[model samples]
Target: MNHRSLFRRLLLAAAAALPFALSVGDAAAQAALPSDRVLRVVPHADLRTLDPVAVSVTITRMHGLMIYETLFAWDSQLRPQPQMVESTTTSSDGLTWRFTLREGLRFHDGQPVTTRDVIASLRRWMARDVVGNHLGARVTALEATDARSFEMRLSRPHGFVTYALGSAVGQIPAIMRAEDAETDPSRPITTTIGSGPFRFNRDLWLSGQRVVYDRNPDYVPRREPADGLAGGRVVRVDRVEWQIMPDAATAAAALQTGEIDIWEQPALDLVPVLSRRRDIQVDRLNTISTQAMLRPNSLFPPFNDPRARLALAYATDQAEAMAGGWGDERWWRRCEAYFVCGAPFGTEAGAEGYARPNLDRARELLREAGYNGERIVFITSTDIAPIGRMAEVAAASLRRIGMNIDLQVNDWGTVITRQPRRDPPDQGGWNLFVTFASGPTMQHPLTNIGTNMACDGRNWSGWPCDEEAERLRNAVLDAPEGPERIRLLDALHRRLAETQPYRVLGQVDQPYARRSSVRGMLNAPVMVFWNIEKSAR
Candidate 1:
């Protein structure tokens, strides 16, 4: 057999061998299992690193969340809720944050969670390797005043610090005490201790395949009693089995065949089919942002010009792309901004400049630049199935506009290999590409802009007017969350919208398929499992 075929066989063999090592089927079938309801997630990417600091990918974030706890968590509506913290108060200057640690909380190991542990965990994540994806430097300092009182001082005011914790930068897996990890900054914590309802158990089959989490007998959220499953409080599942069957077809078949109990985030195409099944519960949700974006770096030419980017946007067929990516009629809600379009934030700003299928405009702009269909490279992840499908359709759409499109679909590993590196590396391994959330703080305001949109922005798209964008971003940050704050952000969104910093192509319509027993669906956009404990059968 050829090398490719041999590799495929080896992979399949390895996957088959994994279940046997842990006797997964037996463990899953045990009636005594806490998680009689296992949630099987079929996503485009696998959870690679469990070290929270190293984890920023969406897939890893979702899975990592079940085993870790952050300072704060979110409800479906995007409001901040306390998870590990009893209350978080910001100083008037907004430079320091004082958090009251939730009492009676214990990591899976039965060690009580203290302010020291919280500070230590954050410190580890603050190390250059972890938060580096968003922040340039770690926190200036972390001080635990007492056993349960802690204060963090940011180099500058970061109004949305909690949002960052809840998002991608939450703890990475490997259940050890944070104190230990913090002591050795260079050593990555493969295991960790967490105060979540679920405790990590090593008897599981595979690393990313089937991780089994048993109910933490010690898991008692101070505010919410664990007994009230109907109230939708802490974790209810006695055990949680995370089976990584990356293929949607396989996951669906497993659901139908009774091999799995639930699917965390199913393929967009299966929403209808699964929704129609009365035996299963299909929980649907409206998230904050779902649009697949194209990052044409304007820092360099062709892309640097707003007019050029707008022309490119006008040239492509967004509707067609979304349809293909989402599977026929199953795409996400379209959006025009990083915040949900039509959301409070979206309404104040974000109108016009999508360039939506105006072929004539695209032709006109291209002619203005020098008429030619030279090949432009587009980079994306194969693990991101939607983007993969979208890229294929996008290439076709651009081709019709006389743009010779060379789309490169690489592994998620390779796609992000050089992502953290300076763009234009090796003469820019890519040109135009699609990217997702820079982070909660990336919109404007230097603090925010640097999170996602800075030219040095981790997801930078080679835009030239980055300096100008940064200025607007800084202005928005200066404006807090008030009428004036809204106006400032609105103006920044409008500026970026006009510049096509990144097209807010659409917001993903997140759907969770579980047993009829589950509720608490409308949580925040990250799709974390913090509140799932209260959702009952």
Candidate 2:
């Protein structure tokens, strides 16, 4: 056999041998468990890393939600609500903040959830998350006051501290045990201990195959009714199993056969077939739509030049990109706004630049910028269907703009993992990549990772540096939430467009499928398991 075939066989053999290596009890326990008590799901991607700081993929964040608890959480109405925190008090200057934990909080290991744990967790999160980093910048110190209370003293008053703790966006400040939380921010946690509604089953974790989570019976949910990601998080199912099915057809078949309870993200092409099933119910779950984006690396040539960036922006047709990415006409919308299209801060500022595809204008601009024949390394992920299609459309557009293209295709995990590297393209750096996030995640400046225009080239994957955009972003944070704040946001949007850090392709409709027997699923963007009950066929 050829080397490739032999490697494939060896890999498959190793995967099959993992459960056995863990111990025969692992496989037997999984098979012997009652199916009625377990909720089987096919997540969008595999649960590779447990540390929220190490990775921030949607699926990883979903897993973090299942295994960890935060101090605050966003409600259905997009308001911050107390989750683990009992009450928060801010001094008159808004610089001193005190938070007390709710009663009877305990980690999975039965250790009481103390203020030290909370402080340590937030400290680690502050080093990684953008919201946390911003909050940390103004903080003088974070200390544990009492057994259950923590204090945050800031150098200056900042209004987004409470919101940052409970943020549902990228790198949420998930609380963990003090020891586990003490792990270096640069490294993943050694333990998976958390105080969330579900307890992660470390023994049953099989990387690309399956991972198991049992209901945390000791978890003390809040007295209030469950909202978006806040309030009560009562676990209805006894256990939850995430079976990673890389093939869309296989997952669809599993869902139709009632072998799985929910499919976090079902392929659009197979939605029709799955919708036809009598036992299946398919519906769009995200309250706010999702926006696809093309992020250009500002450290590299071609994209680094504003004229070159504008050339690509002018050449891109959101309608065509949406059509290619999301096939159905009803599945996507042409949104040119930087913020969420239907959100409160949504404005058409700078949208005129992306109104249409002007190839002639794009070519002329490229020529004026002295377009050197620099190779553009475009990263694409085949594991995620929508992203793959979007990358294809982007590649076609760039080629048409007379640019050299080196399209590198890999899995979603690899794409995200490589986007952070700052090496030259030939030495593992990337020129561009396509990704997407829910509208709610991008609606507000506090949670939006895309709009962070840090002056130092130490921002998100693209690494775009614009001091004026950063200043406007800070201005929005300090301003009260009103029309005045929105005006500031519009100005920020215009500057961001001028900098060309990233371009929004369009908005897409994300629909999830579940068995008719499953009920009480929240209408939120993230795939939540709490409050959802599953019945046997």
Candidate 3:
């Protein structure tokens, strides 16, 4: 396909779109159009589990925002603030830390939040890969100081420990009951229980449409004032009805019709149009999210050699791609850095090491890789705001290099079909689709890359298992967030880049749309809806 031909075909390409069908029924609207006092949260997908340890879905991430409270929560700036822990202290050696738990806290079951429960939950996540093998390995041991106090001893210093605790696994300790123990980690939470502001009525677990939770009156918060937010934020809403409206169109229509109070980014293509509308409000995350997409051609045919994959990856003009497909706006940018606001390890690579847009180099590499024209499938999911547009650019670049390519877009669910751990090929079937893996913890490469996803991880592509990658990954763990970390992470990212572990296209923006009535919309690197407590509607 010619570059122009590819553009024309992709820009106008349409997939089987599931109609976003949600209606603010007249019955509810006429029967006292439920007051703004009740915040109606409309998510693109339904929440999956109450068990914080294994809930990996977007809906689970959303529901997690409501039911669970972590030790340290991120503010608009990604700074850690107190949520469950009243105060925390680090040891002189920088390995052991102690957290003074907030008092008067009660789980949904009315059991007082205790140190034992936190320890148990932490142990569960670490022991069984709740979050993954990395975190479990990091935790040296856990001991309760008292009912409301406990200490975490780490094998190495973690600069982002506060932010790390904000992950689902760490937060599991705070949300689940001490007595609630399951034999399997992947199993769903049979009942929802947590120390957050709201408590769900247990009966709604299987309805698949709506999950209900009400405010926990006994809650006593340990205030950590937010920067942009005005005053103290305690949960005000008596009830929260999170509706799982399957389609974005339905969610958008519901929001426009006043059926749903909040609908996360209706559609990326339509953001500009929605921004012009006066009735609804748009909230963009202040964090500048950018990532490199590294696709591997070396694994399969046509791309059987390392040079072939490298040719495509290097040939990718990220600068233009992000602009053409994503946006020149702050939300998108040439990553250069491994992680946006990259941890200390980012310093090691310095400014020079990052992959810059190099068209000439790309062309040369493509030439070196043996330029026999062959079409390849550049696939991705249409769940977030940016991927669809990006797929077009990738297809364009390959076409520009005289490569024939077909673009395939799949739903997020279908793209990431899960299988048993023993079956890596079925997992490879999932690799047939394109998707992005957003780690709960970004600070630890050992945690993120080595354990959870580096070699043969769930959805890992090109079948990776590099011993050197495993070595560098382990070296960075015990290091602090300073120079040592910089050395490890920079090399890790660079190493992965060289190997073409998985095609890293870009770190796409996770856009969310909130109601005008909603207030205190904070931003973080994660998909969090906890600020719903601060929203008025």
Candidate 4:
């Protein structure tokens, strides 16, 4: 049977076994916290790292949103709005900007937040985040003007200063304590202290099993109501517990029995079963589509050759890949646009021949690249259902095009940790991996980590180095938002097509399932526990 059929069979079997699974011992019940005061959720992945600046993974980013706060945040309209900053001023030349912190901001350790902490946090974030790096390049100086204020002097007029600081995608600009922010950007900080509405319970953190957060009573939320990731972050629940459940059936059963309040990303195949129940509400919190891609390591052989990368692109069938993993066509669509389909910059500039599958052409390209059956190591996360399915589909497609594939499966945490290694495939390196990001994150060239083809190794994990692509991307960034910018974006898209930095598999909308009792959930790209209340069932 085909992968889609196999997935359907497995899902049906799981649904049939749901009744038996409900008898299993409950992990959340063991906690002493009151059910009404606690909001239990099955997170997308385990919280392996606490330092958000060091890792760009989604789970860590979500964790940071709970305990940390940013100077500014993206509102529902995707506009930058002040979160931590009370007031701001800009020089007439637009080369310098000053910001004053809001009053009553204190870290979880009971220390007042100051400008020094903001400076240190931004400095550390600048060394790691893609957008932060761009902001750092134009910044001449970032100094604390007073105990509660800071100023950033730019070498040139930067248009997206606030946007970069308030970005809701990828690695967020989470403000940290001065001492904790002093930690090297390359190393993960153990300290979890932050000034957000929730405090991470480090004592209750059980690595791969459970992660807990307590509401911070001392948090001073903005007066405005919650909008996206901006405005007031009111914590209604006394505690938020992220209970990790790798199995989709077990998680579904838990949600059914009221053992869990929410399942962040439910398996698409089982959505029908969950939706049939009135007690469970399946909602697509993020309206924007999530773009899935196959990232190939350009630093290694096979994919190192642009021709080989093109071969994989030609071999990929967007429709087949989407159906294999995402199942329902209602949630996924074939999108060849590298900048995300339906976005303003989204275009099929040069994706005519390669976007659709051409097995004969793929074989020809592989032969031209002089591939001699070298094993291509493809790492996948079994914990994330779609990722594993995408990897399986991609591996099968590569094999049909005569590529030797070595598929390795691991949990989401392990996959993320191993993705950074630049060693050879035999020495813990990976040739390809399947992952997805929100459309907002992939919409703009600057915010799109996949489009960052900087020759420096500091780019995204794939390490795709293309001078021409880099030049085109920089041109797009510099061009004003109009015909000129659109022209440059088209050029960049065409160049990326030729270089094949990464292959866009498809676009999908993954919904979150929650018990009807879980109320006040915000609709943002990343999950936020704040502004959520666990009503008595």
Per-model CA lDDT versus the true structure: 0.57, 0.82, 0.55, 0.86
Comparing 3 and 4 on TM-score, the stronger one: 4
Tens-digit lDDT string for candidate 3 (338-393): 34334433332432433554556666766776756655655565554355656667
| lDDT (tens digit, per residue) of candidate 2 on 62-123 | 88899898999988877889999998898998889998899989999999999888888888
| lDDT of residue 401 for candidate 4 | 88
For residue 58, model 4's alpha carbon misses the true position, in angstroms, by 0.6
Query: Candidate 1 lDDT (Cα, whole model)?
Result: 0.57
Question: Which candidate should be chosen as best, given lDDT against the real structure?
Answer: 4
Q: Where in model 2 is the C-alpha error above 4 Å?
A: 1-27, 368-370
Instruction: In angstroms, give how far residue 485 of model 4 lies from its true place.
Output: 1.5
Q: How far is candidate 3 from the true structure (C-alpha RMSD, Å)?
A: 6.8
Q: What is the TM-score of each candidate against the true structure?
A: 0.75, 0.92, 0.73, 0.94
Model 4, stretches more than 4 Å misplaced? 1-32
Clashes of each: 48, 0, 17, 0
* Residue 328 Cα positional deviation in candidate 4, in Å, after optimal superposition: 1.6
* Candidate 2 residue-pair clash tally: 0
Across 1-537, the per-residue lDDT of candidate 4 in tens digits comes to 555564456456556445533332244644555678888888889989888888788898998989999999988767899999999999999899999999999999899999999999999988888888878888999998899998999988877889899977767899999999997788889889999999887777777778888889999899999999998999888888788788887787778778788999998877877887889999987767899999999998888889998988899999988998898899999988998888878998998777679999889988888898999999997788888999999999999988889999988888998887899989999999999998888988889988888887787888888999988987888778899988888899999998888999989999999999988888787889888888787
Candidate 4 scores a C-alpha RMSD against the true structure in Å of 3.2
RMSD of each: 7.0, 5.6, 6.8, 3.2
TM-score of 2: 0.92
